[model samples]
Every structure is written in structure tokens, then in C-alpha cells.
Target chain A: MRLKCPLCGDRDAREFHYRGAAKLMERPEAGAGEAAFYDYVYLRENPVGANSELWFHELGCRAWLCVSRDVSSHEILSVELADAVKRGQA
Target chain B: MVDLTGLSALEGLLPYEVDGAVLSAVSYGAITSIMPFRGQKTAVNVRLKADGGAALPRIGRVSGPVAKRLIWAGRGQYLLLDLRRGAAFDTTPDPAFDELAALSDQTSAWVVMRLEGARAQEVLARLCPLDLRAGVFKRGHVARTELAHMAVILWRRPKGFEIMVVRSVAQVAMRRLSGAMDSVAAQAVLGEIS
Candidate 1:
């Protein structure tokens, strides 16, 4: 599979390291309690259809990307730099 | 105080040649990495223009003259390669734009190799997965990719290709590239025979 990096254009998936779900984008506050922290750290949704993921462009731009893909078909729907996503720019 | 002398990582194993390719070490004096601070790209470009007579290069492009080339390494990152032998840039960030950009010396971190020949593309195709067909990856293009599991920065030149690998993996890089060169040359020989 190939991913189109926002800055480096399209690249082979082998150059990227899959970093799991993009839910890490949202973190519970320090005072949000034990269960909140537990859910944030360990509870993962077994997403089946449209899924958002985090991938590191290990060999290319070294940018963290938030990828929205169809889990069942492996079709990539969108790719954005994690920085931009975190900044609400993308 | 202990005295130290700098030696090339591939001090004796390079300048290798075969029927179709030549692999040799490049003594790139100093490589400086320039990373613009967030929202300071324009300011950094202004400084770069005033300093090097060239602006920051676009993604996958190279700018400036052969002596002091600026290569786009990744998003907001540029590598300044001082090609003049014995010339070195300050490892510390220049005070001119200390806040606009972050500068770091990469001379000791990377080892460069030049591969040029009639079959240079074939030799590289055996290891790198990039599309190297003529006109596709034209001159002045740069890409960060892998060659034989080792991360490498590849730059396309008018005559051939320049590969930059980490210093620690220099030997493995040479071994793999030379092996590819031998394989390509052997394939050509067999073709000629048949």
C-alpha cells in the first residue's frame, strides 16, 4: 500500500511505521481520574469500517501522519500531517 | 589534551568500479541541517537568501550552486552541503537567525557516496524502490528512502546519483550497493553473451 504524505507526496507504506490509532490525539486531563486515564491508555475501539490511524514516516519525511482509512478494504481516504491536525489546520 | 584526526568511514572500501558503475566516497566538508521554527519559515528564507544567495528549496528540490547546495530533506528541513573540500560551517547555530531556525551539524552523522555510470539506474534499482527512470526522477530531485533496509537520502544529479547514509551503516551501505553493482554488471555480461 502507498500513502500520500502531505509534504513528501506519495510513498510506499514500508517507509512508514504504523503507530496505531489516532485516538491519542485526545488525552484526558491530569485531573480526569483513573478510569479516564485507563480508557485513554488502554481501552481501544475495535474499529471495523472507517478508522483514523497514526503513522510515522520513518524513512521519508519523518513526519507523523494522521491517516483516515477504510479498515476493511485498506483504502486510504485521507492523509494529513499530525502537527496540522493537532493545530486544527487540517 | 588528546589529539584527534578525522577519517572517512569508508576510508579504504570505496572508489570501486565495474563495467557499468563506479562507487566512490565524497568528502562533503560540512553538512548543516536547517529547520525553521514554527511560523518562521519566511523569516528563515529571508536569512537563507541573504546568506547563500538562494532561498529555501521546495519539497524534493535542491537549490544553490554546486559549492553550497541547499537540499530539501523533509518538511521545513533543509540540508546545506558545503562541497568545497576543507570548508566547514559552524556547528553551532549562527546568531543571525537563532530564533528563526535551528541549525545542527550533520557532517559526522552521514557518509556520502557518488554512483555514476551508464548503468547507474540499474544498479540503484536493485536496492532502492524509487522510480528512477529518466525524466521521472530528474536532476536536482532529492528523496529520503531506504536502500537495503538502511535509510538513505538520494539526490539525483546530471551525471549520476548521490547517496547519503548514516555514518554507522556506511559499511553495510557500501556492501549492498557494490553487490547491486556486481549483479547488474553480471546481468549485462550475460545479456551480451546470449
Candidate 2:
């Protein structure tokens, strides 16, 4: 498989590290409660179809990316910089 | 104090000339990494333009004055290469824009090398995974990737290319580059015989 890095262009999957769901970036607010913190720390959903994920271009541009991909077919619909996504600019 | 004047990462095994390319260590006056402070990119760009007469380069690009090249290292980062001042360039942040950006010396952190020749592309193709065709990776293009498991920055120059790798792994990079050159040379010889 190949992942197209926004900065480095298309690169082999070997150059990237799959960092799991992009939802992980949304941490709960400080002092939000134990349940919220627990969910944030350990809960994950195994979605069957389309999913948003976080990936690190460890050997390429070294940038974190948010990739919208299909779980069943492994087709990537879009890729954006994780930082931009965090800043609401993507 | 220890006498450490003539030390180099390659230990004198540089300026190697092969059938298709010449590998030589680059002696730069100064090398620094510049990173714009959070939300200060615009200010940093203005400062860089005032200082170097050019804006920060986009990803996979390079800019700056002729002798002092600014290469985009990654997100929000650039590597400034001042060739004319080899090892003597000041690395401290210019007081005029110290609040806009962060500057760090990288001269000793990296080992710079240049590969140039008519067949330089062929030699590089053996080790690099990037698409380096003239139309694709044009002059002034930069790429941060791995060559033989060693992280490296590849910059396409007008005549050939420049490669920078961390000093800790410079020996491995040198060996791998030499091996790639030899492999390409061997292929050429076999093609002629066939």
C-alpha cells in the first residue's frame, strides 16, 4: 500500500506508521470526570466501513496526517495535515 | 583541551570520484535550522524576506540568496546553508527577529555531501525511493526520506544533487552511497559487454 503525504508526496506504507483513529486527538477537557477520562484513554470503536485515522510519516516528511479511508477496501479518500485539522484549518 | 581541528565524520574518505558521479563532502560556512514560533509564521516570513531577500520555501522546495540557500526541512522548519562562510557563520538568532523564530546550529549535527556528474541520477536511483525524473523532482526540490534505512534529506541542484544525513550515521550513509555507485557502474559495464 502507498500513502500520499501532503508534504512528501506519494510514499510507500513502510515509510509511515499507522497511529490509529484520528478521534484520539480529541482529548477530554481537564477535570471533566472519571468516565470521560476513562473513555478518552481506553475506548475505541472498530468501525467496519469508512473511518478517519491518524498516521505518522516516520521515514518521509515526519508529519502527522489525518487520513479518511475505507476499512474494507483499504481505499484512502483524503489525507490532510493533522496539525491543520487540529487548528480547524483543514 | 583536546586538539580537534581536523576531525570529520567521513574521516577523509570523501571527494570520491566514480564512473558516473563524484561524491564530495560539502564545507559550509554555517548551517542553521529555523523554526517559526507558533502562530508567528507570517512574522517569520517577513523577517526572513527582509534578511535573505526571499520568503520561506514551500514544502519540497528551496529558496534564499545564491550563496545562502534555505531548504524546507519539514513542517514549519528550514535549513539555512551558507556556503561562503564555511564553519564560521554565526548561528545565534538575529536580535531583530528573535521573538519571531527559533534558530539552532546544525552544522555539526549533519554531514553534507554532494553528488554530481552526467550519470548522477542513475547512481541516486539505485538507493533513493523518490521519483527523481527531471520533470518530477526538478531542480531546487527537496525530499526527506530514508536511504538504506538511514534518514536523509535529498535536494536536487542544477547540475546534480546534495544529501544530508545525521552525523551519527554518516559512515553508514557513505558506505551505502558508495555501494550504490558501484552497483550502477557495474550495470553500465555489463550493458556495454552485452
Candidate 1 lDDT, B1-194, residue by residue in tens: 66777789999888999997999998877898999999899998888788755888889989899888899987678998887554254455578878898899888899999999999999898898788887889888999887988888899877799999999999999999999999889988889522
Fraction of the true interface contacts (Cα pairs closer than 8 Å across chains) found in each model? 0.66, 0.69
Categorize the docking of model 1.
Answer: medium
Residue B59 lDDT (model 1): 91
Docking class of 2: medium
Per-residue C-alpha lDDT of model 2 across residues A11-89, encoded as one tens digit per residue: 9777888989888889888989999989988888888888999999888778999999999999988999999899994
Error of 1 at B175 (Å): 0.6
Clash-forming residue pairs, model 1: none
| Interface RMSD (Cα, Å) for model 2 | 1.0
- Kindly report which residue pairs in candidate 2 clash with one another: B28-B86, B29-B85, B29-B86, B29-B87
Distance from true location, Cα of A53 in model 1, Å = 0.4
